[model samples]
Target chain A: MELIIDRLTKQYKNKIAVDRISLTLNKGVYGLLGANGSGKTTLMRMLCGVLKPTSGEVKFNGIDVSQEEYRDSLGYLPQDFGYYPEFTAYEFLLYMASLKGLAKQSAKDKAKELLELVSLSDSAKKKIKTYSGGMKQRLGIAQAILNNPKILILDEPTAGLDPKERVRFRNLISQLGTDRIILLSTHIVSDIENIAGMILIMKDGQIVHKGGLDEIIKAIDGRVFECTVDAGEAGKLISMHTITNFRQENDKTFLRLICDKSPCENAISVKATLEDLYLYYFKEVNTDEKLF
Target chain B: MDNNIKRKLKSVFEAPMPAKKDDFLNQLDYPKASRLDFIKSQAGYIRKQVWVLSLLLFIGTLILMYYFEVSDSVIWILSSALPFISLVSIGEIFRSITYNMDELEMSCKHNFLEISLIRFGILGLANLAVLISLLILLAGKTDFGFFRLGLYLTTPYLLNCYGSIFAVNRLKNREIVYVCGVVTASVSILNALFTTQINDIYTDKYWSFWIISFIILAVFSYKEILKLIKKMEELKWSLSLTV
Candidate 1:
């Protein structure tokens, strides 16, 4: 069960959405972390065979991504997907099941089972437009796994989930990752911090970091620090380093930032987390904090 | 533990009768539907309004046929409206984009091209069925012979289809179908406007001309559908995404 992406590239009129990305994914959960418009969706679309890549190719085992045999083993949930509003959860799943080529009776059974698994069996008959954002997101997850796919690509799967729902989704995805390749993309660092076995960080249409959490965190491990200093000292530190977060308490300013060395004598080294690593690799700090 | 208990259990038909016995048998009869067979079943799942509207249009066509012999002008008007019967189906074939469900459907095992082809097939056949029914009814009722009667109606119908399909191929967004509607309606209106000029063709012997035109239109319509399929293979009905 290998998904091999070779030199994948996509270019739009004004920008290159994805450029020279190559990866070989196996049976595990891969968390694709990137800011918005960072090519996560574009890459996922190519893997799903929905959008043709401008260059290079994607293959599962040996079948090309564009082949029907390849698509038969693939499943995807887009960052944004639309369901027929009038359809009930049951109807929508059955519709998706039919598209996946499942027999009618079996499709019904699978829809029922998935709705139950997603904790939506009670509302199975309710119209989709009436469902909450979290409910709809869970529904999207259900549809993606309807085919028992070997390769499941979920783009921003937890975008609208509540805290409890996010936990539920994480657990469900962990269970699925044991035997299939599950790649989920999101900007929310916490979503993948616990469940994903591997992390892929994309920036400016290219993968700048990818590995296990610890492996990827090594890039900025000792560079992260937290310090509380007077407002005048904070201003000097802000100009010199990337401040991930800041807060003002009393006469002092507390800052969590990344830099080559401590900007102040009071700055203490802190263990870098996936969030710190994420924010580090995310947009460059604008240093917009005000301490006046 | 006893042979008698085992026999009794067998006689009782326990074990839940294989859980949905009828469905198991049905499943055997109907394997997982793919391609054409799956498309056949999808007909029921497509929005019911599509078929209902087509049926209503068919009924309206029947009503117009009822009043066909009122006068030459009425006959011309009925002939002009025949294409719209088929045009009602064009909007529905590309409805996934209109409703924004295309991305979800595009990733299916069938892919967007195959799925849209199925939709195209269903709507096209339905349009043909409506036209064929109208043609049959008019065959006995009209002053023109069967072939001659067909030429008048089919010419406009084919024009509408080709024009609508061209709009689908050349344009982008949800409004492509509306463009189809406008272009088809315009063709019909143009047909209606030049009734005297058209009647002149009938007065003079234009059988060779009509037959040749019919054959060319049919071939081009088929070719246009093929082109749309090829374009969709590359573009996947998603104009928002750059190819």
Candidate 2:
């Protein structure tokens, strides 16, 4: 199966939320990496057919997203959503199942199966408002997959999960991604590094980079350096380089940074990671078309 | 690994499940939920209180009709109270937006547009049933035709619904129910004023005016319903305005 996003654009009165962009997705997990206000949520909303675009279209196979036929095979989890306060997790899933057009018996069976799949069967009868943020998120995932959708779009799915819950979510996503066109967007660099097969970097409403991890990491390969220096020298290096991470132990400060070359005499070149690349682009103020 | 666990794992892997992808997917039957099934489901989503209040009002109308032999007062009482049946429904039906669940609902196979139309359709049919029921109860007491009685009862209901829906679409937040209540109260009071102060406004002397007003209000209410549908479809605009 294939999902094609063709020149999708959403413009507000004063600003363009999502620029004219296009993508062709096959059955794999795609990670959209962008900072807040970078149009990741806006693009996902368009693909889900919840928001009308100023221009362009999204289609699965040949079916346009605006058509009910397209939505029949689609699922989405928005960055923020809430449930009716009175609905239990079970009731909520059944409601979503009906919305997805499942028959009554089928809706019941699917809701039961999904509660187990998401490790929420024990809490199935509990009101949604009583669940933890992670539990609520898992319920959201369960509802999205009630119809066994072919195209799954999750916006910041792991935004507020604890470490254990994040790992569970990642494994769940990895498992679900094997047979669906799953596109998940997040600013959490490691979430993509761990779970996504393809990475798309968005900046200022445009896709600045798209590639596999190895290819994307090449931009900072051998250019990442680390060193332990006195506080005074550490401050200087921090100001001069794009430091992805830094810590001070005793009087010496340790720095992991991205640069064209080692900025210190004693600094050694280290392997670059996605976090470094993410920091170099987002945290650093270089306005170049390509990373140095 | 423990020997027992290792053996169990090996056994499970050796007996790996069959693909059955198409067979299992066929069991889902995602597209089978017909429009009628979806419409049937919407009635339950409307708040319990709305249904209770509507039933209570209908009963109250029945008891009140026993005392008033005058067709004008019967029509006045039924029209003022029944529009609330429409007023509270508009508030409760669109509570998905107030609860922030509309976005999630909009992405579903049925989507928001179909859901809104179905919900409004179901409630509208119920409101019509109540109007007709009241008319049947008072049919023998009135000198006017059944058609004219229907016009009088429907006009005020339409007026109240038009005002509340207009207010609900224009406003935001959970307090929308209160706004609708104000609309219902205002329409009821104005209907009361017309009943007592105008003397012959609800009498046979003004059946023609009632007919004209009913026609105009029904058109305006229908137009307002169309506007509500259009606004519900443009949910993003309203959502962004709130943000």
- lDDT of residue B116 for candidate 1: 77
Give Cα distance to truth, residue A185, candidate 1, Å. Answer: 0.2
lDDT, candidate 1, at B128: 72
What tens-digit string does per-residue lDDT give for candidate 2 at A248-273?
Answer: 88989999988887788999998889
Shift of residue A44 alpha carbon in model 1, Å: 0.6
Stretches off by above 4 angstroms in model 2 are: A284-292, B1-31, B67-74, B172-175, B234-243
lDDT per prediction?
A: 0.81, 0.83
The DockQ-based CAPRI class assigned to model 1 is: acceptable
- The TM-score that candidate 2 achieves is 0.90
TM-score of chain B of each: 0.75, 0.80
Index of the highest-DockQ prediction: 2
Task: Give DockQ: model 1.
Answer: 0.45
